[model samples]
Target: MADDLKFSAPPVMRSHPVNPTEPIDTLPELLNHLHQAAYVEMSTIPMYLYAAFSIETRGYSQWDPGVGASRLIRSIVVEEMLHLTLVRNLLVALGDGADVTFYDDKFMPKYPSTMLHRSPPLLLHLGKCTPDQVRDVFMEFERPKPDPLDPPPPDGWYATVGEFYRAIEDGLRRLDQTMGAKLWAGNQPDLQYVAAYWNRDGGGKPLLVHDLQSALDALKTIVEQGEGLEPGEPTVPVDPVHPKAGLDELPHYTKFQRIAEGIEGIGTLHDFRTDPHAGDYAADAGLTALNTLFNAAYSYVMHMLDVIFRTSWKDLKPGESNFRYHLERSFISAMQGILVTLAETMAAVPAGPTFEYYALPEQGKQAHLIELCDKAMTYFPQLGGDNSVRWLLAKLPDV
Candidate 1:
């Protein structure tokens, strides 16, 4: 029997954009930014999960036009949840408890009016605007074209939110440089607080962002580690907190393994863990590899903020060309990429006991959801030809 599914748009809300540059000198200011970022992360979790649930509700049996697309989206949703967790953890670490009891949607930042401008020749590339409305949202946060003569900023220095951290980093660097070795001895509360975690582990290995060289070296190390290449193959036994071990221990792996095993032709997803035939590249080093990719990506993001704000803070006014939108958009897109890849990879692999029953009736519904994803993709070009969303969508295998 054929199933008929109809498409409907998700709910939209209007609110003011959270301006992070509003001169936050007090703890309240920092807390506000932390809260706002956390809220955004929290809101995204549901959006991704709902997209995934829509697919799960519809069974895998029939060839609904967009079933594959929905499945990919479901994967993206899960990763978004992980990002939310990451941000929440960061907030808690900063002494801001998980208190969203008073968080109103109206308080959430709105899209900038400047972003809505139709005057300029909008460049729609990765993270740029496109035709599809759904896709447009994904592409809206792309980086602007850099001036040729100035030479683009370094990898960590971004033109947007990247500036914020850059400012903080600059202050630390200045203090260290001017005060000599005694800078670390200062009693300033905020400095002390940031210094406390300067060498802390972010789940796997300890991350040290005290200097530019250290930051660069960390990125290189993460990339290398993801490829399963440790320098010198030290005689040390595997530490429980090692990136590889930590990733392997994630709960999602069990589910991924199950899905991989159930697929038709692919063997157990675990096979990728040891198979020499698996691609020899760093990015393809399986789950650990994916973790490394995310970490590197995040490092770049952090670095960019450090540089941008360090250079621009003195001249810029509050709420004028704020980078919050760009930051949020970058996070959303990167997270989406991670989740979709994880799920799709798992589904593509084959291994375990196959279920005898399939949800035939849900196939039509799943297809309908996939179609919505496709329509969303079309909206990307309309948003100024930004291909970022399209790039994200392309990562999924053709539906």
Candidate 2:
């Protein structure tokens, strides 16, 4: 069934052109930009996660750079997730739902590709955690928009991720001031996923954005955590979540810089190939099965998110479980547990899992992914012996 499934590209979400130089004047334009923001945030996850998974922390001490590096990168990935969720919430607050486009050909970028709306295109790669990669791809992605006084990009596009988001922030404020309550006329409060469902210990909690103030707060957390304050600026005091964890409170750019500058050490890294593709292992059944399982699990998580964002929340009766919570648990477990394990295994194979689109027939319905999991167990018995993955898939929402 998995093999017979065809890859389908999702319908394009952008109905209007995005010109950063012009102010967003209409609700449709703003919604399109919000969709782009969600895409940018979602696109970085696999690139960062692949590197984090490649860092072999087995023999490294807690104080070693390798151990610290993995923890640091993983934490950034966590914050990125928060950023994505906040953007989704913002969309929900504004009457539009955010789409998870990672599993579609039209939406998901082929690695070594630039992010949406980024001019002078920064090519992101999926590879091992080498210093060169840290210095180049990761750092560049989080780089601050140089020269605060300079005008916006002449091409009407952004040069940095920070700049792209700054445009969105400016547009949101402008719209709120002008449109007033009518802007949120289609707002669905129940569709907004709140902080209670997110990781508080991660970068920051997911914020609920109903009004202008709350929306601004969400954007503030994203920008501050990503770019930090520019040089020569007074540092804002952060209430550290883990004071002893060292660098946990620092912005992502700072953390990546430290590792790139050799200020922090990293343990042994697997020789995983760069920008791997699913077709790279098509000749080997075992590797193919592993890759399929990994991609299927990934698609499943994203589909669950689409459901969460579009579907309204409802109360449950006695003996009935909340599918939303189940979906959330499945997402956390699949990313941290299943995906991580598969990544490490692929690294050991020296091939690496391709973060490509994998479609399952009638996706988001639960049964198809469970079937894929069963086949994966047949191919790789140690993937939580009998029914482990099946149990996980069973709990996912069927929307």
Candidate 3:
């Protein structure tokens, strides 16, 4: 079980080395495929965060952190996260139990890498992404398909994340047909999840995937949001309950386009840097320190998720009352907000890497901190509402 989660998990973005001719037919291969799906989603988070965080907000008022560039890139990051959750849940529905791990030590992508090593032909840098980068490069990364309805590209290797998931979808269908109910032997609804954190970040409810239809919804949510297009379908996929944003009718690629092109009512035009900011992180002392803190915080978030999965799958426990269950979710929610702020802070501090994921050497210490916070929650009510997160933040070198 630990081996499955690892997925060669440590040096960052491990390769599956698939055999081109054969489909992902067996259970083990399916698990490996899901693990790769997790990697695909994991690969994007920091890259988009770095770009969004690097936007120049010198004279922006409506959107303080950023208006055009920041909003576009960050929104994609959120959806990428949604994509990751969907895949992890799918893994549990098929197998791996409810405690399946979502990520592992080598979860982070290197400073310069590619999505599935094919989505973008160019090497993606973890630096300040400029308007030109967004228009010329970033937009292309999530660029719409030449034909939205085009069939999945030839198997073996995928040129885009969509094509990759399309292949996975094909595998899911074939296996379901051959194995029938056996394919979803361990389907667990309790483990399923859908993230509706923001007004615009809606659609695709969490599902129990025991059958074909349910599985399709799960897969479709990932693909459609990533680059799905349905005529007469609103692009943003809003959760009617929270409609603060004017229109939620665009996919990730289109959202980036709005920033690259500009929304008439929102703001004025800007130029893509001819000589974009490489964000030479080593040059700045303070920014480097904050980035390190951000990386640690990011790893802790991963650790919390790891605990939640191992507790459920390995130890046979899963519930809101479970410390791992509660803290993992709470920490993620807290960290999401913090990430937005942290990304903004990185943007403010010029010439710095946004954050990078490294293996947390003292995971035991992290676990201890979670335990300490849990103890504080039970015995010491005066600590504050978010003692764990607050304590984690306090660990940074200085304010």
The best candidate by lDDT is 2
Give each model a TM-score.
0.30, 0.86, 0.72
Q: Tell me the lDDT of candidate 3.
A: 0.56
What lDDT is reached at residue 387 by model 1? Answer: 49
Residues 107-163 of candidate 2 have per-residue lDDT tens digits of: 554576655555445667897888999988888788776546545545556767777
Candidate 3 lDDT, 94-141, residue by residue in tens: 877443444454555555554553422445555445556566656656
Candidate 1 local distance difference test against the native: 0.30
Better of 1 and 3 by TM-score: 3
lDDT against the true structure, per candidate, is 0.30, 0.71, 0.56
TM-score of 3: 0.72
Stretches off by above 4 angstroms in model 1 are 1-26, 49-68, 98-131, 141-399
Ranking by lDDT: 2, 3, 1
Question: How well is each residue in 80-171 modelled by candidate 1, as lDDT tens digits?
Answer: 33333333333333344333321232332222212211112122211101123123322222212223454444432333222433343343
Residue 8 lDDT (model 2): 22
Best of the two (2, 3) by lDDT: 2
Pairs that collide in candidate 2 are: 65-265, 66-266, 66-267
